[model samples]
Target: MSNSYFQSDLLSEFDRLHQQVASLFGGFPYSVRSDRYGAFPQLNVGSTDDTVEIVAFVPGVQADQLNVSIDKGVLTISGERAPAFGKDEGDESRRYRQERFTGAFRRIIELPAAADPDKVSARYVNGCLTISVGKAEASKPRAITVQ
Candidate 1:
């Protein structure tokens, strides 16, 4: 009979609808959605006064196997990792547990508006890929002139 009661009922109804939709779709979660959040090659992005710094945690992948590129203000990181178990393994060899991820993976990162595509550099060292994109001169912060 109170306003708070009505709000609570409405919120519960929305929650029930969400559960029903998730069940209908076989209980898919938002975090696993590739379009929403990239699932491979975890990335850390930051920005300084003049440059945007990006670090991708990608182990077991060599520099030759990885590729980094920027196009239309989007940075793409792609690569492949070979399977730990090789075909040479005999039938006696059994894989009781396999947790490592293998095969090809690609992740697209939308760069900020200030990122300059032409002034970008990348390097892979110690299993980490670091990329730095210079910001546009107009986008960099400047001290205002005081009258």
Candidate 2:
């Protein structure tokens, strides 16, 4: 019984050391980062006095290929980014490293309390997709009237 207890304690210590080493080396499957929320098309979400704004960093994607929709206070952005290199028969293109994402991606962002789904607009500018959702009139702060 005493030997079993000692073995259990040793196993627990080993497990703690293993976790520490994993964290130091950025966890397992080094391709994924611990800080990122999801795969493809990182986003920035913010809110103003009367509107909520969302910006997605999507390069090499066209406006027509992108889809933006809001349903039940959730905003979804979907799109596909194609590879820059075209197939060449005579000329061979060698690639060493590619960190860019070239595939279909979907990101869903939750709207703030003041955001109104009906009053939403989206546009693609440069390499970014910007979405703006207006707040309801009642949700916006109002100055009280003094008699």
Candidate 3:
């Protein structure tokens, strides 16, 4: 049976507000990923039996600016979250407590042994990037029927 109290409107409202604050502040922990030189958008890495999944949250970034590829079991996502409001013309120099991320960034993660980079697919929607790497045919589990 479903718990009626779990569907309270107040809880839903609170969850909405919590998400709003997190997005406005560039997600959680506010840490940028970098291999050596340059940072990349925040990402979460995981996998399933059929495919490996990766979700990257990169706001204010253009799809063209992003680069996604899987080579040698390593998945890489590189892109630049251009400064909002179009900071063009190089008007001298001014600085404040700018927590917002700018410039280019990249995040790389190693996939599981069963992941097949050749069969990977990616999609970008509403500033969120999702990549799925299909599992190798040999690695898939086969169902056995009892006689």
Candidate 4:
């Protein structure tokens, strides 16, 4: 076979293997970035000159139900959402449809090297959890004057 043809065949095989692996884990919605399809508490991450900001949309979770922490440059957000229809909903067979997510969930975010773990702050307001991690002093931008 020509070199070009052999390379194309190898690439196609690799692509097929990737698809098979993805299919095996298709049932799981969790991913490292926490942005996978159907992942709970969608997150938006951005960085400013002095801080890294993260916002998680959790419409039904309360402030007390959420927990945020940073360890070894990894930020972890975990919490539980109670069922909407109360603990006792007559019989399980009576329920026809349920779309809401109700249960414990944990999402881990890897922080940049410049993020200062000691300067992290988190707040939950209006169904949104906002987390701010201050950048290290050396990482902040500074204007240098020419001599």
Candidate 5:
């Protein structure tokens, strides 16, 4: 039946994706971003009374190399993680197997209008990048005094 054929095709496509991802990381990382192809850096996003906090997991990457920016209420995180060990020390290519992604990658997130980019602060520590975006005064919750 047509339904059976459709299911068969879908499964085959799934297998192909698995192989591609396996080759990318040489195997899966402990955590994965199902929506995005390739591995997405592990992350945690939360909000407090004053600001929104974002923490990104990026190991084997230098703190100075990362870039974080907010524009039009959209936060963009981008950076390049060089190979664990570089070439030039010895023969470059011709290795039997290679993995661990190298080069540039980017992730974009849309923030709410309350986010105040001008008051944003960011820091990198323990292989985690943390960004705090303050909320606009008008958007922040305030208590009203009774007359």
Candidate 6:
């Protein structure tokens, strides 16, 4: 029998097929992260016994430029960020590199079923937008006593 140099493993073939299937479906798989890669205003989500906390890192954006709202258990954050360097009509300069995100952006977050839409609050400070959604009374932890 001749020795074969190339070998294809079952696991490797499965991984390759998965990638092809994912790409065929628009390259987006269901995940907890943002819908698209490199989404602006990266967020950190956490929870406490009383509330669900969401923090969005948005530097160089003013508080007045942000809009936060909740509808049907979905939290939406929309805002516009102006360019750092304003363009002048008379000055003609070409930008070599622009990394910062500018213009309108909207981020949607799905809240848990226990999240009370009526009890929601948001505040923006130090370029960070913090949103808190109170959990339903029924969802709160309680001590049970044996009768």
- Which candidate has the highest lDDT of all? 4
lDDT of each: 0.78, 0.75, 0.72, 0.82, 0.76, 0.80
lDDT per residue, candidate 3, 1-147, as tens digits? 988877789887887887676556542232223222223566776767788787888888888999997777777788777665444655545766677888877676767778887898888899899888889999998898999
TM-score of each: 0.71, 0.69, 0.66, 0.73, 0.67, 0.75
Give per-residue CA lDDT, model 4, range 3-92, as digits (tens). Answer: 886666787798788777766765543423434445577899999999999999998998999999888888888999887774455444
Window of ten residues with lowest summed lDDT in model 1: 27-36
Q: Give the lDDT of residue 28 in candidate 5.
A: 27
lDDT per residue (tens digit) for residues 40-102 in model 1: 677777889999998888889989999998888888889997776756344457777877778
Clash list (residue pairs), candidate 5:
none
TM-score of 3: 0.66
Looking at model 1, the pairs that clash are none
lDDT of 6: 0.80
The sequence of per-residue lDDT tens digits that candidate 6 reaches over residues 1-46 is: 6545346587877878876765565433233234444566788888
Clashing pairs for model 2 are none
Could you tell me which 10 consecutive residues in candidate 3 have the lowest summed lDDT?
29-38
Please name the candidate that would achieve the greatest TM-score relative to the true structure.
6
RMSD for each model, in Å, please? 8.2, 9.6, 10.0, 7.5, 7.5, 6.1
lDDT of 2 by residue, 36-138 (tens): 3334687777778888888888989999989998887777889898877735334467878877778788776666667788899888999899888999999
RMSD of 4: 7.5
